[model samples]
Target: MARSLVDLLTTHAAHQPERTAYRYLATGDCDGEVQELSYARLATRSRAVAAWLQERGLAGSRAMLLYPPGPEFISGYLGCLSAGVVAVPGVPPQGRSQNHRALTRMKRLIADSDAKVILGGHEVIAALGRLAEHLPELDGITCVATEDIPDEMAAAWREPDLTADSVAFLQYTSGSTSAPRGVVVTHGNLLDNQRVITERMGHTPDVIAGCGGELFVSWLPVYHDMGLIGPVLNTLYLGVTATLFSPLHFLQRPDRWLTAISRYRPHTSGGPNFAYELALKHAKPALLDSLDLSSWKVAFNGAEPVRAATLRRFTETFAPAGFRGEALYPCYGLAEATLMVTGGTVGVPPVLLEPETGAADAAAVGCGRPGEGVTVVIADPEGPRELPEGEIGEIWVRSASVAKGYWRNTLATRESFRATLPGHEGRFLRTGDLGFLRDGELFVTGRLKDLMVVDGRNHYPQDLELSAETCHPALRPGCTAAFSVDRGIEGERPVLIAELAPEAVGESEKITDLIRAAIGDAHGLSVHDVVLVHPGTIPKTSSGKIQRGASRAAYLDGTLAPVGATAVR
Candidate 1:
């Protein structure tokens, strides 16, 4: 296995040092102008960064990379690995008002590692610098600009040898409010997962992928798991060429993702269900008519719930643009597993199934079976028994590819690695997701633990959505949301958010009550907060999972005032 990320770049540099590894697709008058780096160029830059860190007596220490998506991100990451300093990626605070809290998490992570150096672009460097001005723990900050690589930096001496088992980088992920956990990713973990991905996805060593080139565009936030480690790191692993655009670029014009796909003819790319839906909602007819997706081979769909209807409608709409239904690959993964856990067989069509059906119902949409080197089990929470093919169970995965543990939190690490295999020989990673194995294929259900339990029975929010639209013409089917707030020992009470159709904007609460009655009758659950918002008012993450966690946080902080509730806080 390749020891470090630098090794991946170095090997590629040796094979095709002159080939374009990354391309920055511009938006201004320089729209056509591309900023690219050959493997040689990247290695040269990395060496400079390593030497700079060494000169500051911060070599072998941990540092944070807080820059936005660009070649600088690539350089900042690889430079730390090359220098033997642990690399920690910085995440932008989601709650604008809670920026300092986000910084506190970053600060805690850095302090835990005893890291003193921070590497970033002007913006992140500036923000952290200001934070450092008050927090005495933070040390020197280095702005590694792609355009300003000094001559001395280019010729600086390389650092010590890195190994397969050596710690490469630390990836931060969401946890309880009290503590932040970082997934400690090693060089071995990266190399193993990359091999699995490259072999399954069919990226040849000789392939010259365009940087989001030949036909496609992506506006996924570079900070996201799928965005950062999935695409950017995967590109380096297989040596594919791709275009880089900030996640905001797509938010501004989601059509750009399609426009870029149609324009670039990219062989592989895709995001969550919401992205495809957004493109359909935002893109003009003329633009859709002019685009084409036929050249795209692997449109990976995972990270969040993969809705069958969403995939079906997308292929039906984009058919005119040469989008083939067979290119959809519905997969499952999380950062804890180093990215992908189980993916739909690449180059296979997605398996279609009714969302209302739990694992007990089996259907196929051409999403092929699982790959070798991975084992998937559907286990009931009451005990360690595999459910029948059609039974819904918490999806537990055991793989040599699983990550080591969360950094600095051994308790969480132990809890995260409990396995369900017979005799309990080893441990498995609990995904907290629900899915079923059918006809040797996998169909994902909603979260196993996210179900809303009222009285004594269990109810899925999706089922409420699928049934509610029939009761009221104004309510958008499948757009309805149901969640619960803690009510102590009595369990949790339900709340619903249903988006009104464009025509039914006038009728909100009456339609809400009707739908609420329908849901109450069907599921025997009471939805106290029947929020009636516009079609797109509900926020979603880049990968398309409704950020239930973020939404709850918003509601608690008073940013979101549902139909009728006391002001939060």
Candidate 2:
């Protein structure tokens, strides 16, 4: 076992210096212009970066990494680890002054992390310089383009003194529920979670050998935990080759994802549930006919709710292309747990619970059992007592893979990371998620804070959202937000905001009526108001998770513009 990622990179460089470590596609097309990096070159570039940081006496400081999708981000990240600097990965500003959302996020991360320096590509650094006047957070920080550092600097690199408990990086939350906070992850947490992923996904030597050696195809953003720890870092952990591309490219043409899988024949690859839905939206007969996915064994889905309909539809749609139903692996994880907490067996189809009475499509999919050395328990959110099986409660986790806590936020750390149960010996991470275990399989229900109680009945927002989305074709899938707003003496009012499809028009009243009827019939609760909005109007996190809290805030402040007159009960 390697002590740190630096050790793994060093060993791989010495043993297989010429082996291609990564290949980046500029256009997200299999036949597009591509760039490849060998182990030796990556090692040299990483060392150069490490030496540069060391020379600047930044061994114990935080360095923000803001780079476009490419190998440069990987090298810069590894260099931070090699130099013992805490790496803070964030999305770079796209040089558009109107992108205030991205700029505001960057500013927030910089302020929260108090990063001493910023490492990025040459172009990214120049773009930051152009916007430096508007960003006071970069006033005293040093900005360096790691690409400009001389390879000769590698000779001056000194191996950082590190251990299992040493803080490696700060992974900021996606803020799907609330304000983003940096989760403090250690080297041990990273390695242990990688081990958990390997074991849970069955990334064994035999599996790799059977699939024609270890290989991966990914377009997930490297800055996100699901992308960074799951695919990219796991590739390095296994010392395998991963073909990379930009997330934007993948979004522009969903066919590229399947095409990459066909070309690379990777043993394991996946993304959030929304990615599969996007692929389904564009699965033309011609594209499906060209795909050969027999070598794609594990398609793990996580980072958000995994809809049973999505799993079934995706499997049936792509089965003609040799995509196996068993390959649709549904798992569960969060940033505070490093990445993965529980995952189904590699060759098993997802387990779906029996649907509630009169609601056949309301079955929840299981997120698999916990990995080795990890314990998951359901406990009441307001107390220390554990909940019985088949009862939904807060998901509490204890494992080596769990992060230390939130960075520089002791109050949150104690509140979220210092949880305890009646007989549990160690602290457990309060995941703020609601789920239940049935027959040892975890079935996530909904977010704890997003739960709504109206007329003395508890309701999960996702259930209402799902009902509304399936009510009409005009309602976009995965674009509905269900939240509760305080109505003074009227108690909590349920509000549903859904985006219309691009081609959907002039039926806002009809669509809103259908959604209300569907919710009333399915959940037996009348919606307080149904607001139909234009496409892409609903707020979503960078990872595509619906932001119910943000949506509620916007609704309360009248910031969300309705497509038509809202229907109020």
Candidate 3:
């Protein structure tokens, strides 16, 4: 019965003062130097920061929290909650790169949230000062490094009058840079979602206490909802310990993720589908020689479309290291629902749904059933008409964990968050995802927005991308973008923008022919254009979800500078 996250922290501090609540891997590896924060120390630091903010009369305003990957971000985030400030977690400037996408995102978030104060670590604070002219919004804001705040301020900390309805933080959804929509998540949404995650993922007290009550190891960025709400906040909610590191670390060396999991033997650890693929790509014999993942009960994958190939490959590749197929927990959710909406039953292997139409080999991974107290229904995209269990339609959800609405955007809020289905009593949140429920299990097909239509036939971008990827070794997998572009009088035609594997840069012409033939054979659709650019050129969200809309825009604007290209008549 924790009233708020602050209450959970206080209770944990009182009961397990000396228990390690968080461990930060400084070098992003298990063998590297580490930093530990006990529950008592976390409580004290958060209170001290809270008192500092209260003294400055910033308790009720939004504080843009920018921090590199570590414990300081957690402290600042919790401090904002304790002080009743709406925390806007954002990415900090990594270096002197002027055109850094993360820094650009920070500037946009600051403007969108109108955050009056900026709280971050020392390095990021200095980086912001250097880029102040570019970000005029920071001119009127009070910026301070929370790590430098003294401990004596804890004495002045005073709890605010908070209730379930009080706004706790703002989760700004990614993939939209021009008009960032911040989801207004209340304290109730936070608590409810945590409960859903705990029950759905089976994060029970026995599971927690058995793993030394320290069972989460995450490299997902702290700014994303999956990273913040899933591992970080849930750690406080469940009173379990979490090991944290930067996403860059995992990217630099995917082996580090497995190494840390092996060393810690945590009960839960996972990321998006791409993470598993990355680990498999780099899983040399030497890298996984000493690995052991028997204690990993939940490998929750979400924040993007889960791939059946990734699940099969990861489990097969690591089976010798004690990884279980049942551990591959494919979940589904968005920031609007806090984090997890549905996760497959614990200890049960994921189910794959074969295509109900063409492409006999096509299949999609089942996301899972709706969590406890969460109701999910499939409805037609055009109307509120509820579809049958196995029919593809827009996913609708009604849950206590749903956020209030999008901040300051009533139109979008109404369209997405406030929706009344035909003959339904209560409003449901339109997830904008195309999926269906079969035999009480949820399986996501593709995005309603990213769906491509050609010659009056429905085509999913993921299926097209997967076809192109498997066609040739020259194409980089999971780095392709497929969309339909308006071709004047011809109506709309399908276009493919794929990243060329380094070795394939010189074979673009040969690879382009292979892509065209493969796509034609698979879907019987002619590719209007095929542009192959260098790796990392294609746009993606922070969590590495391919942004098809952005790629389409780039193509229309002639900004898709491909290293090599071809056009088919």
TM-score of every prediction relative to native = 0.85, 0.98, 0.97
Best by lDDT: 2
Stretches of candidate 3 off by over 4 Å are: 96-100, 356-361, 567-569
Q: How accurate is candidate 3 locally (lDDT)?
A: 0.88
- List the lowest-lDDT window of 10 residues for candidate 3: 354-363
* lDDT tens readout by residue for model 3, 248-351: 88989889999899989888889988788888888898766788888888999987778777788888899988899999999999999988899988899999
Residue-level lDDT tens digits of model 2 in 10-95? 99999989888898988899898999998999999999999999999999899999999999999999999999999999988774
lDDT of each: 0.67, 0.89, 0.88
Model 1 misplaced regions, further than 4 Å: 28-33, 57-60, 93-105, 111-114, 131-151, 174-177, 204-217, 355-368, 423-425, 462-481, 485-492, 498-505, 514-524, 533-544, 549-559, 563-569
- Candidate 2 differs from the real structure by a C-alpha RMSD in angstroms, to one decimal, of 1.5
For TM-score, candidate 1 versus 3, the one ahead is 3
User: What's the lDDT for residue 306 in model 1?
Assistant: 57
Candidate that would win on TM-score: 2
Instruction: Give the better candidate number (2 or 3) by TM-score.
Output: 2
Ranking by lDDT: 2, 3, 1
What does candidate 1's lDDT look like per residue over 63-165, in tens digits? 8776666778777777787777778877544446447656666667666655666677767656655566686666544445433555478577575577777
Q: Give the range where candidate 1 is weakest over 10 consecutive residues by summed lDDT.
A: 359-368
